[model samples]
Target: MYNLGGSVYWNRKTFKKWFATRPINLKWMLLVILVFPMFAATWEMKKSSGFSPLQLLGLLVFAFAFMSIISKKTKAPNLFFLFYVFLFLLITNLLLVFFYEGSFSQFGDTIRTILPFLLFFYFRKHLNSVIDIEGFLITFLIASVFPISTLYYEILFNPIREVYNTASRGGGLRLSGFYADLFGYMSHLICGFICYCYFYIKYSKRKSKHFIFSNVGFLFVLLICLIGIYNLRHQASWAVSLILLSMFVYFIRKQVSAFQLFVFFIIALGVGGYFYTQIFETLFAKDIAVYEGGAKETAALNGRVYLWKKYYAFWENFNVLGQWIGAGFAQHEKSSVMMSGGMHNDYVRFFFSTGIIGILCYVSFLIYLIKKTLKTRIVEFKFLLLASVIVILMYSISALPLLASGALMYFVVAIASQINKNIV
Candidate 1:
């Protein structure tokens, strides 16, 4: 019920009909909002530790887009319940940081992740009715070129051209380009791999293009992205990229027979097994410490297990209250547990930083996305969701993608565009 002009209104339908008109076509502003994420590396490169133009743009875009969703232009506003839930959790966690470890820098870092979702409601509000999101989708792929180009250029100056490293990535010295961190580098590489793979699958089904030019172009792009990840020697990214490609094979349904697809998967698994055993296993067979897992040694997994063990010990030592919320995200300033080069795992990061409940909330949000996405009928959306799951799961296992919300952001756009389509 709403109180309008001191008069009580009861019927919801009547209120909406009498309230306001739906807004007209808002051209695809998503292309603009995407720029916020595309510049993440450049933003990091600034290292100003102050307000950045990119951040200012993110705030303005999110606030304006949010206001639009809450206002007259929006369709059934309830369609965005998930986004609201996520936003609430993130904002609340931002406050939690202050209570336990009030570090403005940590606050800034948290907000950077949150800002990616600011325009999510816009996708939820307007995109459901509009079909053929290809134009919009291409922008995301194009945005990847920035990271790919910058990272590749960085490789030129590093004097390391080898594809695989043996020491800390084959000891070949994997560089992060403008991203400046292996985790961040892996995040973008995964994103680019998925983007290129999506196009490869999409264009593969396009019957008109010749096999040579069309397939070769897509293959070149996808292969280049894969090479970047391999060069970085990020094991999880390498693993996820293979899984993502396997899914791509399954999704490219029109052109290939079931038998052919099965052969593809077999080849993929065989290659992956061989690579893991030969390259990854041999390089890191021995470590400072060994753990029990089907596939892990301290060094083979790049000491992620060690870091997670450290975080786990810290969490075990926490008080009951601390266990629930962890000790907050500013561990560098507040915690007695100390380590160098930062924690590689995000789940562990969430646990040690936010606590048990915090990690659940973070995971639950992704589960919600997967659930919602499962109901989407669009094939393209399915690909996006699948690729997202692959990268996010891989990242959570082996790296901190605190700033890698681009996939989730695009996933929102893909899912939101399907809402009206699902309404019958």
Candidate 2:
């Protein structure tokens, strides 16, 4: 189409010549750059109730196309860890229908619930460049503040009128930020911490100019998450965070040094202890207007023990075969005068919806994921993801947030997939 230093006709052939020089990988990075905003905005839309089904559909289609580009490289999905759990969910639901005559609504709920996992597969395929991937992650966490900040502002300043009328509601003054519910906010906060901790560890080695900033961000996010968990008064969340942080330290002990780790734990414990008093006084005090019997009300730890007991009873009723596929989820909906809700436990939800066979399959899949992550090369990143996975598992014991926070769990798994690939 062109001669050396000669006038060339601008045509498709000439365009192709120019395009061929650009790297295919860069194209994928560019796709991420373009898509990041859409994802960020979508999270915001969920808060505002602003997005339409059509818009969401379009986003999913674009995501699929983006993932398709990467899928060409690998013959099989590298994300079998995630897919297996998905298969568990599907098989469980089908079994429920066959045995328990599960509701048609369960199918709709299941599909909507699993969409994040699909998007994660897309993320694993399309994320080509470190810069692009990291940039999108950082942006998502940063933009999450929009919803968080607004909730805090409203709680502190405007104060929800209904909240003022209901004394039991007052203790939940903890800022949810952008998340829809208390658990949602805490879960996303944990995810943010994973990103913060991993990136801090990763970049600290390179002595990059951004190292200080990363450390500062890590401290900030960790503090916020800890406080957020405390404010949430979710016993499971606090326990999970402590366990995961312990694991993070254990995983990094070789690199961080014994004295440094000791100091880190001391500082963390001191900070958490200091805030414990404030949180207790503010959220758990009997004298407070929000006190619906103080310790008794706030002390139920979100009624987790009760929830677990109920689910246990339900589990006992099921036979070996019934336990394998579950009694079906929708059937568990017992509408009482006080509430029309069922068990709040994720394990219970899964068990009832799918049965024991499904639970085994799902648990096995999670174990495989952790095993794969252990095998991965990027030691720090894998550790961070593994810690987060542990937190999600433990937290899920109490709060079954299967379909919340833009399906962040899947995103975690997708990022873990990348870690698995890059590690070994």
Which candidate number maximizes lDDT? 1
Instruction: Give candidate 2's error at residue 361 in angstroms.
Output: 1.9
lDDT string, candidate 2, 155-181, tens digits = 457633221112433355444443344
Kindly list the per-residue Cα lDDT of model 1 for residues 57-116, writing each as its tens digit: 656655666666677454643543544543454456456665545566555555554554
lDDT of 2 at 185: 55
TM-scores for all predictions: 0.70, 0.66
